[model samples]
Target: MKIACSIHACSLSCSNLQHGGQRLLSFPLSKQRLDQSNLRTMPKRKLSQSKILGCSRNPQSAVGAPRAKNLKTGQAEEKGIGKFRFWTDARRFKGSEEKCIVQKALYEAGGVRIGGYPKASPIPGPLGFQRPEDWDFLWAPARLALKALPARPGQLVSACPGMMSLTRKRQLSMTLKGSLGEDLAFSIIPRTFSLPDELEAFKKYLEKQRSAKQVKNGSAAEEEAAGRCKELAVGNSAAASDRNDLWILKTAQHLGKGLKLVTADEAVREAAKRRLKSKKAKPYVQAQQYVANPLLIQDRKFGIRVWVLVTGLNPYRVYLHCNGLVLFSTHQYSSETWRTEEGEVALGHVTNYAQNMDGMVWDLKMLEDHLGKDAFDTLWCRIARNTAMVFSSALPQITLAHEALSVQPESTFELLGLDYLVDDQLHPWLLEVNGTPSLAVEHEDLKVEAIISKQKNEMVSDMVKTLNLASRFEPRYTSLRLAATKTKSLAAISIEGSEVEEGRSEHTAVNVMSDAADGQTTSSDPQEDEEADIAGVVQNSSMDVSTDGEVSGAAVASKNSTRQHEIRDAAEHNFTEESALHVVSGGSSKTVQTVISPADRIDHLRRQLREEMAPTTDKVVWFRVRQELQQLGGFQPLMPMFPMKSKSDQNVSGHNMPWKDRDNELVSMLGKTARLNKRAAIAAEKKP
Candidate 1:
């Protein structure tokens, strides 16, 4: 499509070497337009101006609408979205886990949800809708459909692209192993060896353990070694339990489906070999070291399921839900629990919520109350620290994986369920990270179900608020925090004559139509010196193109051009405060500037002051995000836990406390900004 443009040239010149003559010249808009003998006329369809410009007549009907109308002029203009239209595939979410929460939040926020159940959202797949890009967001468990059609800009996705590196069992083990080599602070993950791939490594580890045991028993290593071993051994039972060499064999995929607790004996090793050699078997297994001394609650094994929300990947933005489930085993806890036969049960050891249907589940607050404030506080610190370290270490892997896709970090958000088990020493051990956590609350008691349901609702609501899904689209909205620091304000420019510098002119004529309509050079002959000079002057002018392709800038002339030119602002341009005629004399040190019928600069300043008195776009957004986080309805920030110095020395700055000093440049800046805002608020309150 060709845009109708009119270029008002302040100066024009042409030179022909062959003809030996100088003449006034102009270039056609396009070669194609000039060459075409027949032009196709646009169909005459009588439509409202609002409909033609893609604006809604009624503001209330503009929910989840893309374009917003100008408040003052009533013209439709492209704007940043206030609310997003989401599409969810029920097939992607298992049994209404994610679908329920997503639809509920979308309904509450006045956003539309497209393509309801039996099938997934038809926007992303191959046989999809006509305009898949119309939907602003997509919610699904897997990125299979997204891979078929890459997400376009202005579209958000509920899942991160490369999260499989952290979610998959084998990938996560390998990622953390390479990233956190000697960082013992994050050594909460147990010693794990992937079967079939790391079979030799697993054998070597077992051999080393046996050799160390033999050396401890027979050889006279040292008196100090003996004393340390004696000190480590609290009792004979504890020493025996440590020497048992217990391991859990589990599949890499699925939750609590094929868990088997077994002692690493000759029989077990031979059985593993048989399974690997078998023609029918192709199991992805992980031989993980079992936690022998688990911190039991009411003589039952338990594990904490934490909800971690990650808003970005490159520069990590992580949050933790304050309330989570403490899942308990149905049977009594025992280190000796193991499956004897092929179908024998081991419910006493595994604390999987799915497997233990009749198991007890308590909220974080309940556990905190049970353990008392001080002990729970200490335990919470460990959990938060370990969680931060894991993500910090895994950031590179996740980011690298995401690089293969077209997903934008700003448009992707993920909610991960990280499972952690506490040892007898109150140290939290990392179990696994779930990309698709279950939100189903299944219990016989109505009271427990209600409590869990309320928590999930609050979490979803807080997430929506933090994402700023309810912000209205303002076409003329200016972020003063960014604009003030980045560009000179129009109000600050003097309407009276300002002195021109030696090399720079105060006022120059800029061809707005030529620059904005199309970015092309206009010269009929390249060899002509005068024509080349004219093209150079027009090409070098600075411009700032907004998202909607609107250009805003002051015209700049050539430093060597001597001829003066009069530039007029477009009559339709609403922001034109005044028009100036520039007079540049040949080889002069300064140019004579003339301002004609200038508008009230004081009024512009007053408008800016009034806007600044209220919160700016950036300030309002920052405060809204901070407020949602600080409310702590059901969520808490994991990295910036205390907003002070970290107990561990790994923190990059005092502001982002407890977060490991890795990929923390953006995090530090945010923390500092928050602190400055807090100080400003305190100072404002104390004013007389």
Candidate 2:
């Protein structure tokens, strides 16, 4: 047997040399010629095949010849046909190179490779060297291969470089394909571009196209055009109509004197025109010219003016700035009215002093003066009518002025500020009349700044407005009269106790005299007489009596007369002691006895002497005689009623002379003697 080898001189040598032995296989003679010829003519194919098989052929040698190599002992056998190929033993492809070709093609075209011992040959791990051409070998399992790569920007770019090129749209489309080949191709292209500008342009173009299309659709387009046209027409129409109406109204107003166009509607205008024409047809009267009184207009009644007392120069400027009334002195007075031009008025001859005083004072004075005498009189009367003088220390000048006005006969009077300057002697001078006096003195000590002046001005103004002068003065006179009546009534009711007591004594004397005149008899005994006299004196002293027995009028007159007489008598006697005694006796006694002729006086004296002597001598003499007899008899003396009757005589007269019986017998004897003596006296007088 024999086999040809491409090495230098090698040949198959497996022949048995017997009739039954198999011959060693040899390259066909024709196949060898065809290969030799085709190899020379197709050098590129052969070189490609050589590269595929992971072997190189010498460019100068014939196709079937193998390149020389150093033969080392125990060199490892080549594993596969290509750079990334490996050996695999399988029953299906025993000793068949075609099977290897098929396997390499499938692996290169992204197919799985299957083979060999232990069941399958180990595929290259991810770290194993890979041929650039064998990248598709991993395509079937590239997802897993790619996952195994480090997740870095460069690695990702290497794995799927085309991803950077695929546009956002293309990438999305490719992603939808779900095919690894297209996805890989799509991901591999570079995507560098001006992305932002391109996108903006693209969007604008798209929008433009859409808008163009929308414009072509005439229903919406025509409607929009019509709407715009209608808006413009309406605006123009409204403007023209407004202008026309305004022009018409202005023209109508111009043509019709003092006429106003009140309505926009033509119908209303026509109606108004008709009414105006009708009104114009009627008669017209000229308006009267108004001539205001100069004095009245100049007068400042009820007007409030504010004054700022400034210390600086150009006070008038400040006043002018403040809108104040100003006063200025001038040499001449003007008689012309407001219509005529006249110079300043002389200060000295200013009839209204109020006009001369500037600022708030001027304002007040002008107000009062302008009202004139009659009006001011009315105003003052109204103010004073019910006003009571309110005495308050807070406003001394006002209170004093009020007091003075109250005492005055005129019910209305002007208020004045009397300033006192003590020039050696203290006397108040009439500084000025304050027709509109300030009621507030509370802020007198404040600084004279603009603010304080303004405040004071405002306070005074407010006071003027709030004050009801008419209401304040109405009831003063009535109240004063009532007060006076009360004082007089009190004085009239007051009385003294001594005067009342004297009146009572005089009344008692009268009572006693009256009782005596009534003929009421009393006992003549000496003790009874003394008791009566004491009673009369006590009653006279304690009782008040009038001579005429009346409490008023005639009784008082009689009493006064008696007192006058006593006084006269005392005066005539030069108040001698005896005359004083006589006067005193006249006041006490009811009657006085007078001395007449001697015989008559003698008899009266004899009777009075006998009456006095008998009571004393008889009582003493009888007590002594009774005591002598009582010692002889050792018996008590009998009581006697008759002055000289003895107890024994009383017994002989058959009187029994029981001591009580003796008293009865003596009483009877005294009665008989008194009768006998009266009878003897009567008889004696008859004989004479």
Candidate 3:
């Protein structure tokens, strides 16, 4: 009954119970209960319980078995009551077969549970089911406890293995939780807060950046600069245009203003009027007509009509004409006055007096006579003894001008053309100065006015005054006549000499002799001799001589012959001597014989000897002797007796003569012995 109770309870409570059901059903009573009760019955009998319950027997063929009654009823039950027969031969039973059967029964009962048994395993549940005290001591306390443990080497003490394992699990869980909380605060919280803060910070940063860029670009200053450049360009262009117009206006104004005017003709006319007025105001002199007197006009077919242009009129003409007196005075006067028909004249004269008198002595003498020597010396002294000063001052300008003007064949006052009438005492009297002293025959065109304008009349007057020739003068005819006589005598002598030289037919023999003798006399004078010799040689072939004193031809021939013989003798002697020496010297004998004769040979030899023995020869002999002596001293003698050759035996004897002195005795003995031996040999040969 307990088995039936256990099975029924297990089947009812243990709806998921499997093995326990089989354990309970393995009891025999449990099988019977299972067969009887509907609560724990299976739809088919399991083979495991069939043997235990013996449900496979045939109930009809059984013999004599008692049947049981139902405990709750009084009737007897059949043996196979409430039972179905199973074919057990057809099935095999396993160990888990009964549990499988109970599982199926419980599953069919709709998840019922057995009241007295646990369903899960024997292991404890998770810490969540443990007490709270266990909560701290489990995973959480283990992590804290591990942190307090001493760390192993190469390990981090802070790392908890428990938390690491939990973190791994959470990571695994997060992998499965994908896309679940992405839009929630857990994923986007930081991004949400930082975005707004960043935006506000960015706005402030942008403001700072823009301010810095404005400082760098300088745009406000650039705009101001552009405005100023535009203003300057406009101002410059306008000023340039205004300046261009100003130049044009200034040019037009300049053209409108004309130049100051002038006329050349008006200036010339004014100058002419001034000149005319000046001429009208000046004093005038009447022109005087100069008349020619009858005597002058008759004697000279052409008479000069002279006009005297005087600076002042004279009380007496003689005083004005005192140039004649002052120029010819006997006294040594410094100043003198004389009266003339037209004027009274005062004159001054200067004289150059020089003691040297080398040059211009005649001029000095002439001047001395005009002003006496004492007065000349006085004037020269007053002028610092200067000749040029006295002459240049005392001589009039016209006189010097005339001296400067007179060209070829230079003139003095005496050669000048002037008319002065001679008085009864033969003294010349001056008339008016006539400048146009005409050489022309035509009276009408005498050029008198031109001559007066040139002031040549003043030159004539000054020249007359300088010469002092207006006074008495004498001609030098006697000196001229003496000169003429001397010239004539010289001419006659030249003609005579020329005639003689020409061999004129008119000459006598005595004259020729005289002339030839004169040549000798002329030759005595050295100067005459030189001239005559040159003349004689130049006219040698042209001369013809006829002398009274002459020599005979025979005598002349004899004299010439004697001269020739003397010359020939001297030449023969000189040539023969030269030829002999030349032959002896081993020169050409034929050439010597052709030049000299044998008759003169001795004379020639004598001459050659004399030449050789002269002082010139002495130098040669000394040189040769010294050389021979040097050779003799330097080397052995080639021969014993000086090696001389002789032309004759007498020369050998003469050679011995030099060696006879004691100093030459050895040589003399050798020479004598050699000669004696030679003589003996010659005598012996003659004896045969």
Top candidate on TM-score is: 1
Model 3 agreement with the true structure over 545-579: per-residue lDDT tens digits: 11122325565456445433432343233222222
- Write model 1 residue lDDT over 573-658, tens digit each, in one string: 22233343232324346665434211222122223322222222343223323443544455656555423344465553223323
Residue 215, model 2, lDDT = 76
Q: Tell me how far the alpha carbon of residue 504 in candidate 3 is from the true structure, in angstroms, after superposition.
A: 22
- Runs in model 1 lying further than 4 Å from the true structure: 1-82, 97-99, 119-131, 145-150, 182-186, 219-244, 266-282, 343-345, 472-634, 640-665, 669-688
Give lDDT per model, in order: 0.50, 0.24, 0.23
Local error of candidate 3 at 48, Å? 99
Candidate 1, clashing residue pairs?
none
Candidate 2, which ten residues in sequence have the lowest lDDT sum?
311-320
Least accurate 10 contiguous residues by lDDT in model 1: 537-546
Runs off by more than 4 Å, candidate 2? 1-104, 107-199, 219-688
Name the better of 1 and 3 by TM-score.
1
Q: List TM-scores for all candidates, in order.
A: 0.60, 0.12, 0.12
In angstroms, the error of model 2 at 484 is 99
TM-score of 3: 0.12
Q: Return the TM-score for candidate 1, rounded to 2 decimals.
A: 0.60
